[model samples]
Target: MSRSRIVIVGAGFAGYRAARTLSRRFRGAAEIVLINPNDYFLYLPLLPEVSAGVLEPRRVSVSLAGTLRGVRLVLGEVDGVDLAARKLSYVDPEGASGELRYDRLVLTVGSVNKLLPIPGVAEHAHGFRGMPEALYLRDHITRQIAMAAGGEDPAESDARCTFVVVGAGYTGTEVAAHGKLFTDSLARQHRRAGSGLRGDRLPRWMLLDIAPRVLPELDERLSRTAHRVLTKRGVEVRTGTSVKEATNEGVLLDDGEFVPTHSLIWCVGVRPDPLVEETGLPSDKGRLCVDEYLQVPGHPEVYACGDAAAVPDLTHPGKYTPMTGQHAVRQGKTVAQNVAASYGYGERRPYKHNDLGFTVDLGGLQAAANPFGVPLSGPLANAVMRAYHLAALPGNRVRVASDWLLDAVLPRQAVQLGLVRAWSVPLESSSPETAHAPAWSGHGYGPDGNAAEKPSQG
Candidate 1:
């Protein structure tokens, strides 16, 4: 008898957890293959720390091969899935094409940056989705500060020192919070090195959002806490505001104010990967529709989770689970058990989970958290936030902790590596796991060559 082949696609939080669970359960009884563009699983929650120079890039990226003991790793980006034939086609990193036939398929392909129709945004704004973007933003921030210190033109120096961040969600809030600190450190270092820059002309960070407050989706207390911390740190918190246009000169606010800036970090939100819609599967608002068991309606051999699947929320009637890492992690385990049960190894169960709570790291010993519905703030909240991250991280706990310790005792090393260029990480094509193709291609754009608006997820 031949062994059954189980294929998992896109090793994000959901896919990575699913593969890990299944490998431990099946051991070597079945063939398990994991497909992803990168070899490491990015710990997305801490990506802001990477951009802020609080943590090394490797600290958040866990190795897929080194961790998944019994699973086969396929380095490729899946582009086509033939549900009728149970086969999927993918392109590898070196521009080679490949295909896989599977007895069971798990689709956990995550999301990409949510692009808007704003002019010059796709060209001028930097995204915060993947490692490349994080690295690029760090270098860009450093370069802007370094250049500002030496520039002769006061107007140009001020523009270079001004940073604009759009969106006030988890990613945006963290980015602005950490970014202000990062730029401040760089400016201080420049001054210490005897640069001619003045103390009064500190880097200006403006966080803009159309929403009424930061972390709007989270608890109101978290929002208030974050807003308080940001304002205290000299970050301009611009609520009920948005950008009308972006240009090389700066961004034009919706209120008709042109803010001179060279840095625009776009973190509005994320939509599901284009591959999800390309599957031609039944979808709910661009997410693959699946039952509470995470099984496709007509395809029992196929399952989906993470940001890719609209898994019906059993805990909340008539609603689907939100696209969050907490839900994705639990759903991955549930899907793995259900998949194993399909092979008569165990009994299947429906997915059901209640959100424990959320935490927001607001840079520099300031944090907001509501664990188990108890709201917390300040240094205590910061400790809890770090504890939560360390507990949740799948690997690299020691290294990450060590980095935190080192960052506390030593000054951050802020030097631009000039690794990821600006043109390489276009907003329209910002999925970290996908190959960098032409930005306004047939991927996420509409007939007008602009980003078609879609509902956002985690």
Candidate 2:
């Protein structure tokens, strides 16, 4: 008999872990294939550090091939799925087409950026989801501060120095917190170099959210701690407010107030990948609906997990698991076990994970955390946060730790590589978590026009 083939889609935390577990358990027993747009897995939790110039991009990009010993890495994005025929079509980096047939399929396509219909936001704002956006922001922030020093108009200089970040989740909070430190350091450097800009004039950063408080979804204790740290770091936290419109000049808040800023970062939440719509299957919200076994109902051969799947929280009875890495990582392992059981290799089990508390890194030696429901703050929280991240990362421990140590002692190395440009990192990218060129050519990306191929890989 031919060897059973298992195809796993995506390479985020869940998909990566699934591939690794299946490769080890099946060994030569099955043909394991992992398909994704990039060759490496992005450690998304540290992305804010990338944007702040505190960590190099490569440090967070874990190579899928290096870690998955028995799996074949196929680089491309799956755009279409034929459920009845058990086949899928994808477009490669060179925009070429290909197909794959599988006996068992794992769908962990992950989530994309969430957008609201605010005016001018699609054109003026940029999101912080993937590697390219972080790189672009790092360079863009540095350039804005440096060039503002040489400009003749003080208003324009202040506008250039000002930054507005939307959403107050962990991503937005960390970006604003670390972002202030980064721009402040640059301002000092300019003054030391006699660039006319005052070192003492700190750049302005405004963090806006429609919620009642920062980290509104987290524990109240965490919310208070994060709010305190951001305030101490000079971040203007605007709660119970939202952007009404975005323009080249600045943003208009719903309160009829206007603020001038050259930078607008959209860190709102995410939805399932667009590919979910093409599947022709029932979905919860936008996510592919799957049972506790991670299998799509009525399609035993199809399994889904991670941010793309709406898996029921058996522990909570009626609730679905939130889009988070906490559940996704454990769900991946369960996917492997269930798939094996279907082949008479092991016993299948339902996905059940207890709620662990959350953690928010506020940059520097400040953080808010509720581990096992025990809330902690200040340096103790920071230490626990760092240790948690180090333990969670699959690889690159030394490089990431070394970067952190260097950042503690030396100033951040801020230099624009000019690899990523403005035209590449648009705010309205169809998939917040993925990148593509404008028109996508044969690749099938959409109308907003982010056509640079360099970003699509990440």
Candidate 3:
């Protein structure tokens, strides 16, 4: 008999872990295949450090071929799934199409940027989700500072020096925190190089969120700590405020105040990949609905985990698990075990896990963390945050650590690589895995000439 083929879609936090676990447990008993657009699995949490020039982009990217010894890696973006036929179709990077048939399938395709209906946002703002965005942002920041130094108009220089960040969640807060520091360092370098830019004309960073506090999903203490650290670092934290409209020149706040800025970063949130809904399976707010065992209710041969599946939170009755890296990592392992159990290897188990805690790196030696219910702040929290990331990274620990040490002592090299351009990473694009050209023309009007309906935040 032919060996059973198990196919996993996506190579994110959940998919990567599942592939690793299955490869080790099944050995040669079953065929394990991973389909992903990229050759490496991106470590998302430290992405801000990459944009801030603290860590090289390659340091956060781990090679899949080198790590997954026995798994077959397919380079493609899955576009269609035929559940009854047990086959899926995908298009490779070069636009070639292919198909795969599997005995068992796992969906962990992760998520895409969450876009709101605010006018001009899709055209004026860029998102920070994957490697391309990070790389583009780093160069953009450097170029802005460089341009501001040579500009003749004070108004233009001020706008170029200002950065407006939307959403104050984990990604948004970190981006704003690290961004302020990055721009500040750039300003200092320009000034030291005999540029006419003065010390008082430092970059202005504003963080806006409609929520009452930063990190609203986290504990109150953690929120307070993060707010304090951001304000201390000269970040304008505008709680209960958000953008009403965006333009090439600036953004208009909901309160009717217009703020001039050349950069508008959209770090709002994410929703499940569009592939989930395209499956036409039972779904919970765009996420495929799965049982406690991580299996589709009517499809025993199919399993789902991570951001793509709405798995029940047994710890919290009547609720689904939050879309977080912490839960995604654990669910990946549980789904792998259950998949093996379906083959009569062991007993299947329900996914049950308690909140371990949360950490927010506030740039430099300031951070906030709640580890095992113990609240920490300042350098202690920073240490905990760094240690946690180091321990969690599957590869390149030494290189990441070395980057941190070097950043601590030396001035960051600020040079624009000009690799990623403005039109490549539009905010309305559904997936970060592939770079889609801007779908809107002139302003923020989408293809239908109407703002896309906002999806529910998980």
Decreasing lDDT order of the candidates: 3, 1, 2
Q: What is the C-alpha RMSD of each candidate to the true structure, in Å?
A: 5.3, 3.7, 4.7
For all candidates in order, the CA lDDT equals: 0.90, 0.87, 0.90
Instruction: List, residue by residue over 1-458, the lDDT tens digit for candidate 1.
Output: 26899999988889999999999999999999999999999999999999999999999999999999999999988989999999999988888999999999999998889989998888788788899889888889998999999988888889899999999999999999999999999999999888767666679999999999899999999999999999999999999999999988899999999999899999999888889889888998789999999999999999999998999888889999999999999999999999999998899999999999999989889999999999999999999999999999989999999999999999999799876656557777835543353346555645543345420110
Task: Residues 208-228, candidate 3: write the lDDT tens digits.
Answer: 999999999999999999999
Instruction: Please provide, for model 2 over 1-458, each residue's C-alpha lDDT reduced to its tens digit, 9 standing for 90 to 100.
Output: 36999999999989999999998888878999999989999999899889888889999999998888999999888989999999999988788999999999999999877889998887788888788888888988988888888887888889899999999988999899899989988888888778867547899999999999998878889999989989988999999999999888899999999999889989987878878878989997889989989999999999999999999999888889989998899999999999989998789999999877777878888888999999999999989998999999998989999999999999888676766666567776654444545544664444655443423211
Cα error, candidate 2, residue 404 (Å): 0.7
Q: Single out the weakest 10-residue window by summed lDDT for candidate 3.
A: 449-458
Which prediction has more favorable lDDT, 1 or 2?
A: 1
Which residue pairs clash in candidate 1? none
Error of 3 at 328 (Å): 0.2
What lDDT would candidate 3 get against the real structure?
A: 0.90
Count of clashes, each model: 0, 5, 0
Task: Evaluate model 3: give its TM-score.
Answer: 0.95
Which regions of candidate 3 fall more than 4 Å away from where they truly are? 437-458
